[model samples]
Target chain A: MVNWIGLYTLTSREVGRFFSVYRQTVIPGLISSVLYILIFGFTLEQRISEIQGVSYTMFIMPGLIMMNTLTNASSNTSSSMLQMKLLQQLPDLLTAPLSGIEIALAYIIGGAVRGMVNGILVLLVGVLLIDLPVHDIGGTLLFLFLVSWAFSSMGLVMGQIAESWDQLAMIQNFFLTPLSFLGGVFYSIKMLPNWAQSLSYFNPIYYMINGIRYTILEKSDSSVMTSLWMAVLLTILFTSLAILLMKSGKRIKQ
Target chain B: MPELAIQIKDLKKSYQDVFALKGVNVDIPKGEFFGLLGPNGAGKTTTINILTGLVFKDSGNCLVFGKDTVSNYRFTRSKIGIAAQELSVDWFFSIENLLFFQAGYYGINRIDAKQKIDSLLKRLGLNKKKNSKLRQLSGGMKRRFQIAKALVHDPDILILDEPTAGVDVELRHELWNYLRELHNNGKTILLTTHYIEEAELLCDNVSIIDEGKILKKGSPKSLTEDLGKSGITVQLTQESIDKKLPMLDLDYSIEDSRIHFSVKNPELVIPKIIQELTSKNIAIHSIKTETSSLEDVFLSLTGKSINE
Candidate 1:
């Protein structure tokens, strides 16, 4: 039997850890996302006028929200696990009456919550500043939740793989952060050269942004079905990989 | 009635090219206070890790509560609690929350977890600092909180892997009292420590390991008696005492400016040597007796000092 109580407890602890440092994990993402929306969406839209039949401001808002969600989601799990590893506390959790799947799920759920909450907070910032319009509210929320789960799962995997702080930061800098910006958060794929646009399709974060954009603006640069399927696929793959690494005690064992 | 709380049958684990545990076998019975003595890199922590599911075993098997640790891991883990050498508590969480969450990991309900956390905090003398963040607490307090986290679940067995490392004597003594009380109540405990005195004082049975192999296994008293012999040292006023080796009457030698000899009974032989030295006009500075202890047994068996 799965220890439901133990799973809940581990999830609670993971959630509580980020909550314990809300000012660092939550507020910073919300502030930075809001600033991006203001400087790029509102200020630049005046000169750019419109993109793809919608105001540039509207087109960019979804991307900003997606970026923040993925970043926060990924950072939440990675930093938490990395801190536990460095502090030598992972053994405590390992010794608990918890299974590998339970541990992975707890971390994934924790990261998802942070990602979604930060995503919503950024959306709220856009709603107030750019007067953001929601084309489909339910789809927007669903895409946001799914994207959160996927990136958070990715973060758990990265956290397990990275041994030190510098290593984790390197992954974020070289991969997550750069790929996020290149994924069309600030520029539409159509605005890029054909070569860059094709490459953007390969960037996983591009699909995340495009999926969220389709939910909000009811328009997508790529096939909506493809974006949705990729999101689901990545979530399952990363989540399963995280659970496998944990079960094998890869780099997690004393 | 199952006699064993934990059973290891040729348990083995290796990392890359180094073997941490190589076919080590041990059986710890219920309610027994067992000590695992080893120098650094001798597989003590690795053994505990495998038992707790933190690390995978390469070969052989480990069982707790008569259940295989690998096949029935969660259930076996539920029966065990471990306080590791490192401070593993999250720095952001308060001591109270850390303990409460730890209890919950054992499937304890909220109300019972709270009660258990409160009681453990008090026993560890951490009630006043329950709401304090871990980073704010002193080293000793952190050590105590680690123990509190381990005991929060009230597992059938407790494994302490250097729980008192770098702790002060006062706090160590306090923890000893609490652990003794727990042991007296029929709780099985397996302790691994560098402190031979601590092992001698608390452990009923001990196994000393070196290079991932068990060198000696027995009670502290019996192991010392088997591996080491008592010696009498007769201090002399002059640097040379070689002439008195024959007069001392029992195969003695002067080495390092002192006359010394192994004796079955130091009480009987020490006095006779002192009297003989004084009557021979040899000024005796002081006479001392040395008895075998766990350290001596460990040194004799391992051929290396634990302190080194």
Candidate 2:
């Protein structure tokens, strides 16, 4: 059986967990977004006029939204799972009448919700602060949701593999953070040399940034179809891997 | 035949090369209070984990209510609730909220679980701290909350692994009373502990396990009567201490100017020993006889103290 009630309860608990700590989970991302806008968007706009058809401050809004979305989304699941493992609370969930898929799905939904909330809040900030345009509101929301789901699943994978807080930080600092910055978040890949542009194509996060950019600004360095396909592929890939690890009871089970 | 609540056949589990359970077999009938008594590293927790589906056995069958734990996990798990040995809980959650969530995990809705949650809190004397986060509770409160969480779903069988380990005497007694009440209400409980007193007090049957194998299994009274031995101690005077002991055809050892003899009936042998000592001119300062307990049975079977 699907255990819908169990899944719902677990997902709500995950959601309530982050909601209870709004100061730590929600405010920090919004505050960081404002800082990025004031420091990078305003100051750098005076030096460089506009990247696409929009002002420099407006140009970086999509990237800021993507950055906050993926970061919060991934961190929600990673931290939650890792903390439960470290505290030895996993046996409660494991011994419950929930299947592996149900558990993973609950975690994914929790992370995705956090990710989407942060991403949308950043979008609202951009629209209110700088009058940032939304070329396709429906497409923008869909893209944000896809990116959140994908990164949240990936975060569960990282959480399952890393045994300690230090290891999780290493994975986030060395991998996710670097990839987000290099994924052409602040600037388009066109600004990069041909060699760097070729390397950017290999960064999956680039497609997420490019996809969100297309929906919000109606402008993208890569093909719109390519970005959409990349988001879909990554979502399926990470979700499958998360479910697999959960079913095998890797690390979380003896 | 009366629908055993738990059954294990040749249960074996190994971590790397070291075995945690080796061909273990046990059957616990419905509504029976069973205890698995063993010291540290004796596989008590491992056996509980296997039965609860938190661990996978290398090769064996663990059936709860006649359903295989591995193949029929949903049914088996839903019927058995476990208060694990480790204090594993989310510290951020309040006791009430955690109980609600636990009930929800068992497919019970909020309204359906409220009464059970309230009753458990009141029964465990945790109603006052219902809103307190788990981290803010004391050790004894945390233990009670663990049991509450396990019972919120109202499973047929409750498994407590070392429930009273490290608890104070008063709280231990309180928990024992609550557990006894639950048992009287027709709840089957499987209790594992190294405390011989706990097993003797709470369990109807006990299996004495040592080093991943069960050495003896029976009622506490039966085991003590069958495997245990009574003994008499005679404190000798200074001059008689060095004298050769009487040829009593029994297991006897002399230490610290006292002669100790292990016999079945201390009353029958005490007079014979007193007469033998008098004839040898061994002056006895005092004499004391002791009856064997579960601890003595454990010592005799394992050849060492249970706590050792």
Q: What is the clash tally of candidate 1?
A: 0
Choose the strongest candidate by DockQ: 2
Clashing pairs in 2: none
TM-score of candidate 1 to 2 decimals: 0.90
Instruction: Name the top lDDT candidate.
Output: 2
Q: Quality of candidate 1's docking, in CAPRI categories?
A: medium
lDDT of 2 by residue, B95-196 (tens): 899989888888888999999999999988899999999888899999999999899999999999999999999999999999999999999999999998
Q: Tell me the whole-model lDDT of each prediction, alpha carbons only.
A: 0.85, 0.91
For candidate 1, lDDT tens digit of each residue in B123-216?
Answer: 7888999888898899998888888888888888999999788999999899899889999999999999889898999999998887788878
After best superposition, candidate 2 residue B85: deviation in angstroms? Answer: 1.1
Clash count of each predicted structure: 0, 0
